[model samples]
Target: MISVLFAVLTAISNGSASVLQRRAASTVPDAEAMHLSLIRHLLRKKVWLAGIGLVVVAAVCQAVALATGPIAVVQPIFVIELPATLLIASCAFRVRLSRSAWRGVASVTCGLALGMAAAAPGGGSESVPGYRWIPALIVTGVFEAALIIWSRRLRGNARAALLGLAAACGYALTAALMKDAVSRLDNGGGVLALVSAWQLYGMAVAGVGALFLLQNALQAGSLVASQPMLTLGDALISITYGVTLFGESLRSGWWLLPELIGVALIAAGCVELARSPLMTGAKPPPPRVR
Candidate 1:
């Protein structure tokens, strides 16, 4: 129950964070790149700062949740952010919600709910030792860097999608490492004393890098394109890590059928949502009066 509560809080935080970042990114004109590089310079405004703050808070919540909950239980719950962001967009940003957008949100919500219910509770034990996480973090960082460079060669929507996917992978691996670190801290005494010095630094670096790339991806393309891509991809990667590395389990044979259906619904909804005109054609309204 505590795990479920943490998951829901994390999802809401993440969902709002994405919406805020997207709202900030939308303020920059797409034509600014073609018109003048200096015009693009104005993109470095306070909006991004606010968005970054929200994201940082979300990451902190997520780290705490991972520390306390089983991976399988927590990972699927994060998917709720997709629908939650839509709600934020409607209420906070005054973005018009189209029929297709609402449908997509519903599909994703239902799917994620089903997935979460299908997942079983676990002991949240340390599967991988604290020291082992250092090497894993380094390897994941290198891979994420390679993916970012590779994404640069692609163009338009393809590039944005690839970058979002890469960011998701980076985030998933970071979550896994954080979980290991948190478990290690539970061991007490000198172990926590020794690990605290460098582990926190490493986590901060990884978390910031992932957030930056995710923001870049959102800035580069439509929120519809980037959000669902990142959300769904991140969910899949997290689930993979949960099952393979953390030893999370499905409830029973009956659960597998719904789990498959849920994933399918999520994927289909994300695809539809990503291609929606509301997202692809979204533009900032005129600046409000003070």
Candidate 2:
């Protein structure tokens, strides 16, 4: 039950964060400028600052959720927020959602629901171990560095989506490492020891970098496209790590039949949603108080 609560909180935070980020992105004029300059300008703006603050809160909530639940459980719930975000963005900011976008949202939601239902029932009780995070941190750092270099040569929405995807990957890796660290802790001493280690700081840096790239993605494209892609990508990565690396369990072989059907339904929904015309040409709407 606690895990369920955490998942719900994660969903709410994630949904709200996307909306806020999208609102911030809509404020920047579509023009050519250095990415750094754009970030500075957007951050300095009052609207952007408020939007970022929301994202920060969402991040904190996500951390709390990670501390409480298995990544497989929490991450899937969080991904469902992509559709929730679209609905909120449309209603709050008057952004129109094309039929396809709505279908996509429905599809993602259904898939996630099935996935969550099929997840193993045990709550995680183990704390993360120290020293296990070093390799993961190194891998995430390398990936981020590559993204930074590659991002320089790209432009427009494509660039933004790529950046967002990179950011999501970083976040997914960080989540995996953080889960490992938390699951291995024996006491306050262990937690404190891990906190004092350089790896902890490295994780923090990766998280910040993810946010930076995600914001850049929002700046370059419609939220409808960038948000769903990033969320789905992140969820997929986290689920993969959770199951393959962390030994988190899915339902037993007996349930595989229903699970397959659920997955098929979800895939179909995603296709229908992605094909919606509203997402392809939609512009970010102006920010408004909700």
Which of the numbered candidates is closest to the native, going by highest TM-score? 1
What lDDT would candidate 2 get against the real structure?
A: 0.65
Give the whole-model CA lDDT for all candidates, comma-separated: 0.68, 0.65
Q: Which stretches of candidate 2 lie over 4 Å from their true place?
A: 26-34, 87-102, 118-125, 128-131, 146-148, 180-186, 190-194, 197-199, 251-290
**Model 1, total clashes:** 0
TM-score of each: 0.78, 0.75
lDDT of 2 by residue, 145-191 (tens): 78667877887766776777787887787677666555435446566
Stretches of candidate 1 exceeding 4 Å from the true structure: 26-43, 92-96, 119-124, 130-146, 190-197, 251-256, 272-290
Model 2 — which ten-residue stretch has the worst lDDT?
Answer: 273-282
> Global lDDT for candidate 1?
0.68
